[model samples]
Target: MNTLFTVSVRRISHVCTLKPYKETKWLMPYGNPTGIYVYNCVANQRVPVILSDPHIATWYSCGPTVYDSAHIGHASCYVKLDIIQRILKSFFNVNLVTAMGITDIDDKIIKRGLETNTHFTNIAKQYESEFWLDMNSLNIEKPLIITRVSEQIDCIASFVKKLIDSELAYVSKTGSVYFDTSKFPSYGKLSRMQDEGEPSDEEKKNKMDFAVWKGHKPGEPYWDVPWGSGRPGWHIECSAMVSKVFGSQLDFHAGGIDLRFPHHENEEAQSCAYHNSRQWANYWIHVGHLQVKGDTKMSKSLKNTISIPELLKTYSADTFRMACLTSNYRYSMEYTDAAMENAEEVLNKFKFFLKDAIVYINNNTATHPCQYKDSILKELQKVQDGNIEALKTDFDTATCINNMLNLISSTNKIIKNDSSGYYPVTVTLIVEYITGVLTKFGLKLQDGSQENIFSDMLIDTLVEFRHTVRLNALSKKDKELLNACDIVRDKMKSIKVQINDSNKTPSWVLIK
Candidate 1:
């Protein structure tokens, strides 16, 4: 069966307990309220999602501006979004085509270029490359289409011209193009902005929308448009790119919570004004921001921001990912060095448990292994069965991972208590369960394209390496040979360091 169809069926099965839903169709996690679940939607500040059309799943996420290194805050949202897409494929088996637009042309790029006396395009490209490197290091699934703002200038110019013709936008005397927010009645619907009693002079008489094109400015990159050579504003680029790629309306729209204010609201306003409808997106998904420890928000200006590259130098990408997933998707993640270390400790423990399980299976392979009676397997199966329900309820990843961790810990406890010489061949199931959990969380236990090795191989590698070290120390009377052996050990250590640094590894038999 197709992967998408299989996952769709699982998602359908999860919600069948409520009202009878057709299995052939898939529902998105949005829509108007119905019955008791109406409040559940409000809790997340969205209506309950009943995907009447699973095929309605066109997804979009806001990408980086490419002016600087990506911060951990950005990484959190990107990784979480990637996991959402991956888990849908894994558990719900939904085939989703995800896209994000990179803002290679922006004010920030130009400003940084001016400060450094370099070309804006070069600066943007450099940062964009670094951003992708960081994302790859974290094993973030790349967006299917990474549309660049520089490449999409033609589309953006055409969009602005259409909006001008529709009387939804206009050019100022300075060639600055702005969206006519007043033309769109539901301008702040998505963010639900509160309106004061009466509009002030600027608010009432002026074009209320954000700038679509910021006419030519000093030392900034300029593009040819009907309104003259100028750059597009922060908000309008997304609207133009999304409209060109996914049509006028998208199935789902997402961004960091901070973008929900002026950026997304303005995009919604501009898009709807041009399209002439209240529907800009079928579902709006906003990820909460990551905060600095004990702070309300993380900001580069405040010097509280931690870049992905800097953090990766200290902890493995999986550990960082674990920290990201520990909090609810809708809640803020407060990152600190201590938090990451704690997550690494837990991950190391999980790895050790897996090692033990492997050892048990190897010890038990002697018997015919008829009826497998692993308590760990039973717990894992139960968790897998119920995880779908947790996912369907607004993608409750925190709960889902919690259930998985409980199973891992419980299984470890069971293995610890078992005194029987029958170490149980059912450990294979336990290893697989751990793999499933790790994979769903965007962590790959097995190295890519390489066949997995037996657990004994891992033990043997460490043991052999140790044995070689002792033998060389005792047998080699020459200090120079001892130094050479030490160099080899150092080289292996360096390889381990590099592997850990890049968050990459090939299929392996043993650590040696």
Candidate 2:
């Protein structure tokens, strides 16, 4: 008998250390006080998330089949799922344990090996490394447990044996093993797929039945088992990994919408049959497809798919994330150059606003008790409330982003008016709040590392030189000196730097 696995949880003293600004009249609850709702694909309804343990949550996502380089289509699914995890951690303060499975020994990997005359293991490792590089480039959070199908063959074999002993599966004439779908009446509960007329192949007993283990073929990898010598089937691999890592039940199961049919449905059926529990997962979340601009799905055969490495070459990770956030996670988004360009523009605007605010706070030391503080605080509270509310309702990142934009606009308006005194404390709080929220979305203010000390000194020296030149020009009314100042401004702009001349001292901000 196989022992069920249980997750160990440790009590964390502080999940979030950032405090809200001055504890306003509006108190935004951190935990799921009102019950967070998530869209469940099995029920086809938005269901409230009921956690098995209040302090910890367990979730799983289907990972890549390491046959080739991962494309943007894969990136979209992972990034969206990362956002979901971030929301749970940042907003709900839940300790999360997430797992993803890698199919390293799939049919596709075998085919690639034959075509290239290379070892399948070498190919799997090459692409797996590339996949991690691309994931890092996109700033995706790493899963706690990344199980490869190759490493779980023994477990998979044991699981297949259990089904066989129970007569839920059988050994075929070809020495292969197949799942007897007839034994499980709720086989199509997840996919809602109906049986076709007849068995497609004469060798199989039923058309609905799928392979649990394949017989060994010529020049293919195989493992010795009691009944046969072959590899585990695609569906059995995931089920086995989940069983070993997370046991029978999962808090959430997420992947692209394309996996809903045969891939995820089969896994669910086998898990339910083996564990004898109808509730395999509490919530099944599926992200929409990332389509090409012309309404065609991205596919390798179409030769129109964009790889993550190629995308990062042209755009920053935050830019790509921002483009994904522009649409709802449950709706399809078109990948066009125009869409990415628009995202970049929005990101630049945010950087500029943040730079200006930081500069104003640094230069001005006088704290003015502004008449507009009460009004601004009220508006900020409303925006914060809207952001929290949007995320609570199925993690609507688009709406949350809209609320952040509103907050930015309000901040800009207050700063634009000279009559309203600059409240340093209030501005600091707003900046903290904005950056905190943006970080949760996997976006940061600066793209790369900060400027080195020497580079910073060079910039300061140049700014001081321009200031001296401008002063001389004003005192002596010299056109040449003024023209030299213009030269400095143009030079800075060419290097993607913006100079602010409104303050007593000239300050520069780098534009990523």
TM-score winner among the candidates? 2
* Runs in model 1 lying further than 4 Å from the true structure: 1-56, 194-204, 364-370, 374-378, 418-425, 446-512
Taking every candidate in turn, the Cα RMSD to the unseen true structure, in Å, is: 13.2, 12.8
408-447: candidate 2 lDDT, tens digit per residue = 7878876666666765435544665676688878885565
Model 1 agreement with the true structure over 283-367: per-residue lDDT tens digits: 6677778887576688777788887878878877878777766667767887877878887777776777777876665553344
- Per-candidate TM equals 0.76, 0.80
Candidate 1, pairs of clashing residues: 4-93, 7-92, 7-93, 26-54, 27-51, 28-51, 29-49, 30-49
In angstroms, how far off is 18's CA in candidate 1? 32
Report lDDT per candidate: 0.66, 0.76
TM-score of model number 1: 0.76
Supply candidate 1's per-residue lDDT for 341: 83
Q: Whole-model lDDT for model 2 versus the true structure?
A: 0.76
Which ten residues in a row are the worst by lDDT in model 1? Answer: 34-43
The superposed Cα distance between candidate 1 and the true structure at residue 276, in angstroms, equals 1.6
